[model samples]
Target: MATATYQNGSLSAASLQGFVLVGFGGGAQAQALLFAVFLAMYVVSVLGNLTMIVLITRDARLHSPMYFFLKNLSFVDLCYSSVIAPNALANFLSSSKVISFEACATQFFFFSLLGTTEGFLLAVMAYDRFMAICSPLRYPVTMCPMVCAQLALGTYCGGCLNSIVQTSLTFQLPFCSSNRIDHFYCDVLPLLRLACSDTTLNELVMFGICGLIIVSTTLVVLISYGYIIVTILRMRSRSGRHKLFSTCGSHMTAVSLFYGTVFVMYAQPGAVASMEQGKVVSVFYTLVIPMLNPLIYSLRNKDVKDALKRLGQRHSLVRDGSQ
Candidate 1:
């Protein structure tokens, strides 16, 4: 157990004081409201992503490369939302918002892992679209079942490796400083700020790993889409261009929201916790993005709408027959 005590301008590492997690300094009313809001978000995220997964899995008509990647994306979104939302909701409801040191580290590890995996997944999806549009003749061969599976595996593995390195380095330094985390979750910067020991190594590692992943993934997605745009422009039929753009609209929106929020959060210099502002930004990526995923994809997708209609008609017919 790490004992926490304040000594002058710095924290004393000689005594190990256990840490507690205090989320958003607010009273009972605020906590209750916050809890309700997070609970609603968690429910929506779970239901939305799960519905997509089930629909994609059960619908034989959706047995294609596109839907397969969508199914994978939904699964990733569900897990990603679950990793942070429930714990956040718990902290919001409780007056004593304390998380064990081990648990906090675990949360960060899994969150980083899933986040990196999602980045890779999005990049891969962009390449899929590129092949489909830019080289239609090679699309089927390029995105074969085996190739898709390998890409998915690589994304997961890359995410896991990145998380391992980041989490290990972040926690290696002694957190002899005050255990008061300014944010809702155990993000790298917040946790790093509490170190009783030096964190130059941690910061470098954090910036390096995060930057490399974001830059590499963004570059790949951009290059793939660059070719895709050229190919779309070459098509003489306006309807064909529109159809192609529409198919990619949902993915593009999701990728923009995700990468945009992440970039704002982690990319800038001198970007520390700004109390209320930080929480709001965190909400965009952690809460709002997860909730919006299904809505963004399904609302714009004709197949999803058709499937829902079919499901509703079947239910209606079943009710009439039962009556």
Candidate 2:
């Protein structure tokens, strides 16, 4: 809502109509190269997530609670990649690299929404694994269709609330100092750095909310896995142990990637780093992780691979028949 004002070659708060995203610094060729790289990543990530969603939905074999959550996670990754990747790619090729106030706010909202939703969804998936491994007899009753739907709905609602609070608080601050966002996107920390007013309260609230979400969800996952580990140790069958580990391994890999980058970004708020360093780390979570998720799941899980193979065969048969 900040309007741009210019006076005698000077930019003022009134003149702040939009923000300049200082994405990356390089010559024309370098930027073009970066553009190509990011575009390829974006394409791959979108296609991979979409494929996962379609496979999960179409395959009746994947109708369980685990795949139900996996499908939702893939959808979140699809949207999450979109919230930042396309804009960043365009900025890589654009001269001005300017984003309107509305666009910035919108991007921040959906980015936070999907990120928060994914966090909670991961924790829920962890619980699902724990139930299956530890309480296999009661798993069906515990994680019924209604329960799974409710859990998914809860994550979406939680994400919306978190996004509303964070986005509203962030944009409420008076950004009189400058409109240059050092990082690639309109993230909390980068935007906070641009505010002229005292941001101690904002910082505290942001930290508290983010900490609560991350710490609480992480604790749930850890506790779930702890019980799972115990159960695995007690199991008599070696094949059973291997199967459970394989199923859990993919989820653990995703959790590690997501939580590792998030903790680095938010845990040490006092640790100062270069904008370029922040950008690199952000790229890992925002872009790289999403793209890696489907690969991790499919390559590790035989069920998904089998599903893909079946789908491929069906498509080939249909094509041959049509010809």
Top lDDT prediction, candidate number: 2
**Clashes within 3 Å, all models in order:** 8, 5
What TM-score does each of the candidates earn?
Answer: 0.92, 0.95
1-323: candidate 2 lDDT, tens digit per residue: 35566554444433568899998888999999989888888898999999999999999999999999999999999999999998998898888899988899999999999999999999999999999988999999999999999999999999999999999988877775468899888899988877777889888887788888889999999999999999998999998889789989999999999988887777567643777888888888898999999999999999999999999999999999999
Whole-model Cα lDDT of every candidate shown, in order = 0.82, 0.90
Angstrom error at residue 26, model 2:
0.7
Q: Give the TM-score (vs. native) of candidate 2.
A: 0.95
After TM-score superposition, what is the CA distance of residue 222 in candidate 2 from its true location, in Å?
A: 0.6
Which window of 10 residues has the lowest lDDT sum in candidate 1? 10-19
Residues 1-323 of candidate 1 have per-residue lDDT tens digits of 44456666565433434456667777788888888888888899999999999888877787778888888888888998888888888777666668776788888999999888888998998988888888889989989999999999999999999999988887666665567777888888777778867787777777777788889899988898889888888899998888788878888899999998877777664564575676788888887888898899899888887887877887899999999
Global lDDT of model 2: 0.90
Each candidate: RMSD to true structure? Answer: 2.6, 2.3
